[model samples]
Target chain A: MTAALSTGPITAEEWGIVSLSLRVSAVSVLGAAPLGFGVAWLLARGRFAGLVVLDALVHLPLVLPPVVVGWLLLLGFGAQGPAGRLLADWGVTLMFRWTGAALASAVMAFPLMVRAMRLSIEAVDHKLEAAARTLGASRARVFATITLPLAMPGVLAGLVLGFARSLGEFGATITFVSNIPGETQTLPLAIYAALQTPDGEQAASRLALIAVGLSLAALVTSEALSRRMGANVHGL
Target chain B: MGFDIDVFLQRGGGQIVARFSSGAALTALSGPSGSGKTSLLDMVAGLVRPDAGRIAVDGKVLFDSAAGVDLPPHKRHCGYVFQDYRLFPHRHVEANLLYGWQLAAPRDRWISLSEVCELLGIGHLLRRMPGALSGGEKQRVAIGRALLSGARFLLMDEPLSSLDALRRAEIMVLIERIRDDLGLPILYVSHDRNEVTRLAGQIVHLGAAHGVAFATDMSQGEQGKACA
Candidate 1:
C-alpha cells in the first residue's frame, strides 16, 4: 500500500470512478446550463401570477434534503413510475445507471445554477433593451446580444457552482441510482465504498486528493474566466 | 414623411394634452421644463402609451386608439437619440453602432456604418467601451447608433443638453451636416430657444398653460419674438 501510494498509477478501477465522476458532472452541468438560463431569465424578467409558484418549484432542490430529492426522482422515474415506464417502452432506461447519476446530480445542482443566472439577468439594464427595440432588434435578438452578454459573469459563476455541486453530489445520486461499480460509482460513491472495505485506505486517500485537486482547479479556472468575461462586457 | 399627433397623457397633479402636425425635415419641439416634450417623444417612439391619441408618421398610422392600430417601437421605423446617450455599456462603440444596423432589412438599409462613423467622427473610437468615452464622444456614438439603423425619421430629445458649450456647438454643426447629407426628417426636442432657431424649419411650442401651438416659415428674430 505504501509502495502503491509512493509512485504508481491509481488502479484502473479507481481511474474509472474518477472518469465516471467527471463524465456525470460534466453531462449534468452542460445539460442544465441552457435550461437553467431560460428558467432564470423568466424568473428575473417575467411578471405573472404563476411566477411565484414556478420560482419556488425551481428552487425546491436547494431547500429539500438531498435524499428526499433523490427519492422523489426515483418515485417519478423508477420503472414502475409512468415516466420511467414510458422511457422503458422507448428503449431508454435510467434506473440504477450512470445516466441516473447524471440526472440526479443535475437536479441537485439546478437551483444554484438558476439563482446565479437570475441575479445576473436582473443586473442587465432595461434601458439598453429599450434602445435595442428602437433600433429594430426583436426581443429575442436583443436578449441574445445584450442581456446574455451582460449576464455572462453570473452564468459562468453558476456553471462553476453547479459543476462543484455535481462533483460532490452524494445523497441524491446514491438514493436515485444506487452505487454500482463501473456504472454509477462516482468519486464520492467510490470513496464511501473504500471506507467500508478493510484495505481501501490508499484508494480513498488518493481519490480524496484527486477530488480536492479537481475542485480547486475548477474554482481557479472559473474565477479567471468570469473576471475576463466581466471585463469584456463592462471594461476595466 | 411627417408626424401628426393628438395625445393626452396623465401626469402628476395634472393632465397633458399635445396636438401638432409636423412635415418639415427639421421640426423642433420647444417647450418649458414641465411641459410634456419628452413624453410626446416617448409616445411617438412607442415607449409610452398615450391615454388617448391618434399618431401617424409620414402617412403611416403608428397609433390610433379608435382604430386599435398600435405598432410597437421595433416596427415604428424611427431612430431615437436620448439626452443620456444610452449606448450599450457592454458593447464597444462599433457594436453599439451596429446594434440596429444588422437588424434592419436589406432594402431598408439606408445608412452604412462607414458613413455614420465618418459623419459622427467616431471611426477612431470604435474599439473603445462606452464607459471610457467622454460625454461628447458618447453622444456622437449615440447619434451614430441611431442613424445606422434604416429608420426614415430621427427623434432627438435634448441630445445636446448634457454637453459643454463647446461640445454642444460641435454637435450642432454635425447635426446641420446630418440634415444636409442624410436628408431624413429629424424631430429635435429642446427647451432652448436658441437651439430651436438654429435647427428648426418649423417649431411646435409646448407649455403647461397653452398645451401646444405651431408656427412655420418665420425668420430667427421673428421666431424668437413669437416664442417669447
Candidate 2:
C-alpha cells in the first residue's frame, strides 16, 4: 500500500477502461440520435393534446436523480422485467453488460440532445417548407432537404453534447451495470475506482485528466462544426 | 391557363371573401395593403384552407368546400413565388431549382432544368447559393424553381415588392416573356398600379373591406383604360 511515484505509460488495464469508455459513449450517442431527432421534431412542430406531457417526459432525465433513472431502467429492462423478457425472446439482453452501460449513458444524455435539436428544428422557417410544398415537393422531401439541412448545426451540437455527457456518466452506469472492469467502468467510474484504492491518486488523476481532455475535445469539435454549419445555412 | 377562385377565409379579427374567375394568361390581383390578395393566392396554392367555395385552374379543381376536396399544397401544382422568395438558402441555385424538378413525375415535367434556367436567365448562377444572389437573381431562381417543378400555373405573391425599381422593371419584362412565351397562366398579386396595369391581362381589384371587383375584358389594348 506504499504510494510510489510511478510516471509511466498508461497501463493495459487503464487502456481497457479508456477504450471501454469510448465505445460505450460512442454507442450511446449513435443509438440516441435518431430517436432524439424524431422526438425533437415532434416537440417542435406537433400540435396535440399531451404535448406538454411528452416534453416533460423527454426532459425528466435532466431533473431526476441519476440513481432513480437507473433504477427505473432496471425495472423496465432488467432480466426479469416485461421489456427485458420481450427482448430476451429476441436474444437481446441488457443486464450487467456493455450495452446496458450504453443504455444508461444514452438515457442520461437524451435530454440535452433533444433540447438542442428541438430548438434548431423550431427555428426553421415554416414558410420555406410551404414554398417547397408549392413546388410539388412532398412533406417528406421538404423535411429531408430543407428542414434537416437547416437544423443540422443543432443536431451536430446535440450529438457532441450527448457524446460528452455519455462519456462522463457515472451514477446511472454504476447503478445499472455495476461498473464491471472492461465493460461498465467508463472514464468517470474508472476514476472513482482508482481513487478508492489505497495508493491510486496518480492513476485517478491521470484518468481525470483524460476525461477533461475528451470533454474539451468534444466541445471544441462541436463549436467548429456549429460554426461551419451556421455559415452554410445562414450564409453569414 | 385560367383560374376560377372563390374563397372565404376567417382570419384573426377580419373575414376575407374573394370571388373571381379569369381565362387570361396573366390575371392580376391588385389591392391596397391589408387587402387579402396574398390570402386568395394562398388559398389557390392550397396553403390556406378556404372556409367555403372552390379553386380551379384551367378546369382542374384544386379545392372545393362543397365537394370536400382540398388538395394539399404539393398536389396543387401551383408554383408560388413568395414575396421574400423562399428559396432554400442552404442549397445552391441549381440544387434549389432541381429540388422540385426531381420530385416531379417524368410526364408531369413540362419544362426542363436547362429551359427554366434559360428562361429565367439564371443559368450563370447555377453554382451560387441563394444568399449570394441579388434580389432579382433570387427572384429569377425562385421562378425557375417553380417552373421546373412542372407547375400547371403560377402564383406570384408580390413578386416585385421586394425589388428595387430597376430590378422590378427587369423582372416585369421577364414575367411578360414567361406569360407570353411559356403561356403558363399566372395569378399576379400586387398593390402597384403601374405594375398591375402594365402586366395584367385581366385585373381583379381587392378592397380593404374584403370586396373583390373584377375588371374583365381588359386586354392589352384596354389595360390603360382600365387603369384610368
Candidate 3:
C-alpha cells in the first residue's frame, strides 16, 4: 500500500482539486439540507393534493441518469436560459461556474438527503405534536420543539450522505457547468482529465485515493453521529 | 371561570354530542372510552372543531359556524394530555416541560416548572430523556409538561392506562393533588370507573341515549356498570 501510494504523490495541483471538491460539496450540502428537510417533512407528514407526485419528483434525481439531470440543469440555468438570463441581469452567473457545479452536485445528492429525512420525520410520533398543540404551542413552535428534534438523527445522516454524494458527483457537475480548471474542475474531473493525458496516470491515481479516503471518512462520521442520535432519541 | 362549551361532534361511527356549560375555573368531563369522551375534551380544547355547532370558552366564541369564528388550537389556552402520554422523546424532561411555557402569553402564565415537577413527582427525571423513564415516569413527565405550559384548563385522556395497577394507584393520588391544588378545570377521559369515582367531582357520561348528566355519586360502581 505504501509503495502504491508512493507511486503517485499528491502534487500541489492535485491538492487544489481535493480542496475544491471538499469546498463545493460542503456548499452544496449546506444549501440542500433545509430544503431537503422541508421537502422530506412534506413528503412524510404532509397531507395534501399532489403529495405523491411531489415525492416522486424529488426522487427523480436519484434514479435518472446523472447526465440527464445535468442536461436539464443546462437547459434551465445556462447563460441563455430564462433563469440564467434573469440571474445574469443581476450580475450572477451560474453556467460553467463553480456555483453551477455546486448546484449540480446538490441536485444529485438531494434525493439521498430527502429520503433519510422523510423516513425520520415519518417515524416521529404525531401524537407528540398533538400533545404540544394541546399545551398551547403554535404549529411552528411544535415543529421546532418536537418534530425537528425527533427527526435530528435522520437530518444529520442526510446531511453527511449528501455531502459525500456531492463530493463524488461527476457526470451532473461536468454536464451542467463543464470542467473548467480551478473553478468547476472538482477532484473526479481533475482525475479524469489527468488520466486522458499521457504520463498523467500517477497524478490521477493519487487524486483517486484522496477521494476514496474522504468518502470513507464521511460515511464513518455519519454512522457515528446517527447512532448516537438514535440512541438518545430511543432512550426517550 | 372563563370558558363554557356546549356542542355535539361525531366520533368513531357514533356521534359524541355534548352540550354543557362549565364557567371555567374547573370543568370536569368524565366518561368511558369510545363514549365520545376524548372527542368532547378535544372540542373544548379547540383541537376538534365540531362538524356544525357553537363552542365558547371564557365567554369567548371559540367556534361558531354561523359567526365564522373558529380559533385554532394554539390560540386556545387549554392543556391536553393524551392517553398514551405523548412526551417529546428527543427532549429531556425539563425541555419538554418548558415547551408550552415558552408559548404562553406572559399574563396568562399559571404553573411553573418547579411546581409542576414537584406536583407530578418528576423533579428527578428532568435531565433524563423520555426513553429512560418507566411508564409511570413518562406519565408524570407528560402531566408536568402539560401543566407547565400555562394553559388555563387541563384535558387528560386516559392518562394512567399504560401504568401497572400499583403505578396507576400512585399516580391517581398525584392527579388528585394536582386537581385540588391547581383548582384548574380538567376534562378527564377514562374507561376506568374507579378513576372517575376517585377523581371527578361532576361527571358527564357519554354513549348514554339520554344526554349529559351530573354523576355526583361515586359509590355506585355497580350502577355505573349496569348503566353501560
By TM-score, who's the top model here?
2
Model 2, span B1-228: residue lDDT tens: 388777777777777777767777788887777777788888899888989988899899999999999999999888899898888888889999998888888998998888887777888999998989998999999899888888889999899988999999899999999999887889999888888888888888777652433223344533222321
Give model 3 RMSD, 1 decimal. Answer: 4.4
Chain A accuracy of model 2 expressed as TM-score: 0.93
Interface RMSD of each: 2.5, 1.9, 1.9
Docking class of 2: medium
Tens digit of lDDT per residue, candidate 3, span B50-80? 8777777556677887888888888777778
TM-score winner, 1 or 2: 2
The regions of model 3 sitting more than 4 angstroms off are A1-9, B1-4, B11-14, B21-32, B56-61, B208-228
DockQ of each: 0.59, 0.65, 0.62
- For model 1 the local lDDT of residue A24 reads 97
Chain B only, TM-score of each candidate: 0.90, 0.91, 0.82
User: For model 1, what is the alpha-carbon lDDT of residue B116?
Assistant: 86
Residue B87 in model 3: lDDT? 77
Q: Any idea what lDDT model 3 has?
A: 0.77
Candidate 1, A1-236: lDDT as tens digits:
12246246776766788899999999999999999999998999889899999999999999999999999999989999888998998999898999999999999999989998898788777877888889997888888887788888879988998998899999999999999998999999988988777887777788888889888987887777667666655551
**lDDT of each prediction vs. the true structure?**
0.84, 0.85, 0.77
**Deviation in angstroms for B69 in model 2?**
2.0
- 1 or 2: which has the higher lDDT? 2
